[model samples]
Target: MAPAAITLAAEAPKLSAANTGFMLICSALVMLMTPGLAFFYGGMVRVKSTLNMLMMSFISLGIVTILWVLYGFSLAFGTDKGSLIGWDGDFVGLSGIGLTQLWDGYTIPVYVFAVFQLMFAIITPALISGALADRVKFTAWALFITLWATIVYFPVAHWVWGTGGWAFDLGVIDFAGGTAVHINAGAAALGVILVIGKRAGFKKDPMRPHSLPWTMLGAGLLWFGWFGFNAGSWLGNNDGVGALMFVNTQVATAAAMLAWLVYEKLRHGAFTSLGAASGAVAGLVAITPSGGAISPLGAIAVGAIAGVLCAMAVGLKYKFGYDDSLDVVGVHLVGGIAGSLLIGFFATGGGQSDAAGLFYGGGLSQFWKQCAGVGGVLAYSLVVSAILAFLIDKTMGMRVSEDDEVAGIDQVEHAETAYDFSGAGGGTAARAPQPAPSATTAPNTKKVDA
Candidate 1:
């Protein structure tokens, strides 16, 4: 293994206790988002399939962490390899580095940065689980995350964030994973679903979320943790960029929530809680890439745009005939694209870089650059992810039996259920009255959507 060496920041290489401590807290917050996502997805699934939905996300915490320590971090942040990937024998197993060694030019110990980035690596694939919920086998999902993280995520992170990465060098301003995390996971979700095909009885069965409260709690937790996910991307608060990111995160999320509720009321006649929760996430995704670049007012516009766009997008599956069980492709993919491109119009010259956006007289130059990053990652992830899913499906079978899916994936896959209504009320002597089937009039309620 090669020994770790220092590449000093132009300013001093001295470690700041404040920065280190702040980042450590931020890492914890980001780590919390995985479970938050699990709850978000878990609640959206049918009662019989909730555990499997939760497991699909929680398992990534285990699988990706081990991989990150083994070689995932190395492939993502090690020495530049042809500006396409990273490589450093020293980074494998996170060995050969001293305790105090800094990461490139950062103030925190290399360990802190690795763990922080590891959180990102962990959740990116978990984000895809939302779309594949209830239909996939646990074993196949695990294997797929392993391969997808290594084959698709690691290299893409290098491409967008690592030093000497092509997109980074081209000045594509992804403040924090508009491309690497959200867009990549969203596209991969679309790809895998395309290969696996739709869930059984897609349009026939009423696949509404079993628990909106759980989804709401999950969304709230995600909103809380996102401060860390966005602000901490600046590495530290030394330059005040982190503070701006924090502010913009809040501003944009609030705007998106309101925008979505208004749209829901106008179009559907009532604003549902699911719409509110999903709208919040849409804003979060949209603001993630542009928060550090745009001003607060600009953030409101981005959030509102993404809110409506994603709200309208979630229905595309029904229109186009693919079953994205959750709106992963809609919110994450579309929102990521909106946020990344909006940077070209909203980036103020005072933020992350001096690149003036179109509204600020930067012209169409930066917009084209943003398109390159968005299009490149989307195309690569979609094609490669489809291929990976196909290979995994062919080898071990990705979907469970249709009978098993109908019965409940939790019982088949995990041998457990989220709730046991069987023994309720001491196996009640008399059953409660069941709802009446249609006799005179069929209800025409609008189905609740994610």
Candidate 2:
């Protein structure tokens, strides 16, 4: 690692404590988003399994933080041996990263910066498990995350952001984490959902959300924290590009909200808060890959298109029998692909975006590159996630028993409940009621549809 005082003469202005401080705070702000995700996902599930949903994300914070300190940073950003993975020779257990430590040219205490980036690494995979909720065992999940982070996330993150990775060599312009975060997670989410199979009563039960208000609150927090997520990609203050990313974030979100509502009104017969919230997230995902490179108008188009595509994609669960419990496949995977592909034609250079879409005649080179990046991440993630899930299932056992599942994971797995408003009634009040027998027919009558 470089010393804090070491300066590159021609590498723009060096990062200062003021800039570093802002970034450190932003990094911390981004870290809080995982818990925000917990609340968002938890609120969308049945009340019985709410705590289990929240636990999935919280566990990542505990597990990934430790892993990052161990070797996650070293493997991700260290010197490149080949275009495969980073050579793990420095900053093990936070040894070389001093308070005044420097690396990657910008100055921040390397420890602080590492912790900031670590939060991103931890949450990305956790975000995908939303598709497999209420099924997997807690121990099985822990083992899966530990393995998946090393196998899937760390390698891809290195390829995109680390010096020795393939995408870095190929000039793939993922300003933040379009491929690493969204596409990788989205593909993995799809894999796990398929492996887990549909939830027991998916189509038959009315498994509606316990609280929309909580879901809305979680989405709001994610939006606020995302400023740090998107803007902090620059890693320093006073970068002209950081300001541009910030503006694009809002523009894309606004367009996405409008587009989602318009689509919902046309198809569902009513606009829903869920649709708006989902649309905002779609915009966020779409803009993630192109935020720094594209213009405000480009962001608007990306967000609008992502909103519509993701909205349409969400309905696929009904058409196909996948049951990606909360539409992770629809929103993150689909939206990530849409944004990545669109940016190829829309990305501009020379402070003027002469780069028009295929309809406007930019041809197919950029589009093909974007597709290549997307396809590579998707293929790798599916294979790795399947292996990891299989290993964990065989070792620790992937799911709880059917009886425990019927009783709810919150009570069985965690010994807790999201709501305690039943005084002492507890399980009786919380449990679903049984239907009484009808007196119109004899109790002994054979109940036959035939």
Off by over 4 Å in 2: 1-15, 350-362, 424-450
Which lDDT value does model 1 have at 245?
A: 96
As a whole number from 0 to 100, the lDDT of residue 179 in candidate 1 is: 94
For candidate 1, the 10 contiguous residues with the lowest summed lDDT are 1-10
Which number leads on TM-score?
A: 1
Across residues 1-450, which tens digit of lDDT does each residue of candidate 1 receive? 323333333446778899999999999999999999999988888888899989988999999999999999999999999999999998999997789888777789999999999999999999999999879999999999999999999999999999999999999999988999999999999999999999988988789899999999999999999999999999998788899999999999999998989999998999899999999999999999999999999999999999999999999999999999999999999999999999999999899999879999999788999999999999999999999999999999999999999888999999998887877674344576657878666555545332
Residue pairs that clash (backbone atoms under 3 angstroms), model 2: none
Query: In order, what is each prediction's RMSD in angstroms?
Result: 4.5, 5.3
How does each model score on lDDT? Answer: 0.93, 0.82
RMSD from true fold, candidate 2: 5.3
Candidate 2 yields a Cα-based lDDT of 0.82
**How many backbone collisions does model 2 have?**
0
Residue-wise C-alpha lDDT for candidate 2, range 58-108, written one tens digit per residue: 999999888888888888887775887885656777776556667556766
